[model samples]
Target: MTASGRSAALYRTVWRWHFWAGLIVAPFLLVLATTGAIYLFNDELNDAVYPELRFVPPAARTVPVSRMIGAALTAHPGAVSRVDLPAAPDRPAVVFVAPAGGGEPLRVSVDPGSGRVLGSLVYARTLVAWAEELHGSLMIGTVGDRIVELAACWTLVLLVTGAILWCPRGRWRAAGVLWPRLTGTGRRFWRELHGPVGLWTGALIGFLILTGLPWAGVSGDLLQRGSAALGVGYPASFRTHAAPESLPMKTALGTAPWTLEAAPMPRSHAGHAGHEAPLPTDDAGAIAGVDRVTALLAAEGMTGGYRLFLPGDATGVYTAYTYPDRPEGQRTIYVDRYRFARIGPEVRFADYGWVGRATELGVQIHMGNYFGRANQLLMLVPCVGIWLLVVSGVAMWWKRRPRGRVGAPPPISGTRFAGLVAALAVAGAVLPLFGASLLVLGAADLLAGMWRGRVGDAAASGIG
Candidate 1:
């Protein structure tokens, strides 16, 4: 093929891939962008929507943490599973309680000064929680999680193919290539809007996808297993020789740091045989444990709000977890219920390996926790831009599509086709879910082509 011919074939091949990937994942991308944009300001949004439950008047004097827990437990019928100390004097303390009879956990808000139960409700029913469920799992459990992961993987494909198609040919000018040509109409106008907007937002979109993948089902699992195999997983200091047969942090505690969710829970040696112990089994004992840990954390300069997950059983340990607005302030410490010694070394951001630290920082930025309001606004740009890109893409397709046909880019043939297929196969190997869906879609496309060819042949013979 001539140089021009090769260039044309490349563009056509890239366009075909971009078109199919976008068409498949556009709705999912829209849903993700919308939910993510809302979740960026989850705390602020929750405060606004439920001020009674989330805020309190600033006071010079505040009640003890034990009093807050006691008030919440008395008001709600459950064991106090975890308590979140307010970040500020003006914010209410939140206590999560699991019912003795078994049911959804309740989040109780308490006034800091008076130890009054401000309000209580099911945690899962909260707006922010609902949004998170939808974003992560579409509220449909594991199946939804897989679907979201697949969409995320294909989104990477879309970005790569889009970038290839966006490459400038001939003279790179400011008109249609650099900026949208607003003066044009119909397909021309939509094309200008789509290409330039995509070019501007593509890198940010790719970053978001890459960062978000650590939370995905398949990819996240792969990352964890891979990191563990390489011995760069959670810090070794976070683990102890004696592993407790306790629930995972996510199960025992309502929320935990992402890196430590799967890490084994350290056993409390307090009540174990031949162990020096003053195990706390009663409410008062639990309260004293909370007091001791709270003071210890404060003395150690662990500030900016922390959660204390109360020991559930005799073997259970008190877990103090705090993921502050700053990534560097992230801390997770487990204290033996009776003996009250640290379970393992205090797990902090500094303890993470380079890969773990990078993932944590990226997640912080992705979730708008790194720089607060400025970070939220900066992240919002790509989210809103993605919505616009989806709209412009659909509009362009609508304007240029034929009367009764799907307007996919023309298929390539011979070597170009084989190369594109191989590229997709490689992508699939890296992203299993995306690769699986790619195979299914490719099969469907092939079968559809065969069916159409048979129909055309039959019609031609009849005409003859």
Candidate 2:
């Protein structure tokens, strides 16, 4: 082929793959972008919407964490529990306790001053929880989760390929390409916004892909390894534990939503773990006297509302995570409940290894948590950009759809299908979602090829 022909062929191939990627994944992207935008400020929104449950009296003296836990336990008998301390001095300490009958998770909000139950709400809060459930799992368990993961992974590819296709052709200048002319018809208007907005938000979408892929099970592990190689480390404080079986009704309260139910505790062998002595029961009176940890926190400028969590198990330790805007500072720190000596701090931007820092920063940017309210507003740009991309992608696909009836063999070999297939395969192999999609596409292609071959044979036989 001539040079001109070769260039045309390359462009056609890129366009075909780009079109298919956008067509198949746009709805998924829409779901993700929209849901992610809502979730970006979930903490802020939750606080605003549920002020009564989230906030407490400014004049009240905060109660001990143990006392709050005790109160939560008293409310729900035989419930596995986990407590989330309020991030502010004037907010209620909320505990989620799981019930024995597999009922809805219980949320108990307690006033820190009087040790009195302030209010309780279920884990589900109507629309907010609905959005969360849809965003997190699509309410479809592992299958739905995997599907969303695949869509999220491939969205990066869509962004890249879309950007390439958006490159201006002929007389189209960079300015025209990057911004709408405002004088165009419906199609041109959509096209202009589609390209520039996508181009602008491409980085954020890519960041989302990187951060999101870490939840895709094996794929996530692989991504984590790659991140580690680049110097990223997992947050040490983000440890998972199996809940103890048959925990005391008191001990188990306030653990439900966080624990996923009571788990089988790891057994210690013979002399290593067997203790004839009874487990230390919660002495609320003794807990009240531990002034060292609270004083240290206060001295560190962490005055006011914070819960000092007491780990119920042998491996557990007391922990506290301060609110971002609060006086205690935005960092997460843990202290031993007994000794009150600081054990360690949870992962923060400063704590990241080189790659970990990049990852955290990227995620922070994506989540709108890095630069306060300004960052939150800045994120809206990309969220809207992604939504526009999805809309335009669907428009482009619809505009180019074949006019012929359904089930017709698609026109091929005109668009360098080989090159398109190769590019797609490369992307699919690296991205988990693309890989799964390729498998589905392969099955469809095989069936189509077989059907076409049979049709050709029948026509040839009739001619003979």
The prediction achieving the highest TM-score against the true structure is 1
Best by lDDT: 1
TM-score of 1: 0.90
lDDT of all predictions: 0.80, 0.60
- Across 5-51, the per-residue lDDT of candidate 1 in tens digits comes to 98888888788878888888899899899999999999898889888
Q: List the residue pairs that clash in candidate 1.
A: none
lDDT of 2 by residue, 20-116 (tens): 6676677777777777788778877778877777777864467776667677768764343345656566777776666545667777888877788
Off by over 4 Å in 2: 76-80, 100-102, 173-176, 186-189, 225-232, 235-352, 399-429, 439-443, 460-464
Those runs of model 1 whose alpha carbons end farther than 4 Å from true positions after fitting are: 99-103, 239-247, 270-284, 417-423, 445-464
> Would you estimate the TM-scores of all the predictions?
0.90, 0.75
| True-structure Cα RMSD, model 1 | 3.7
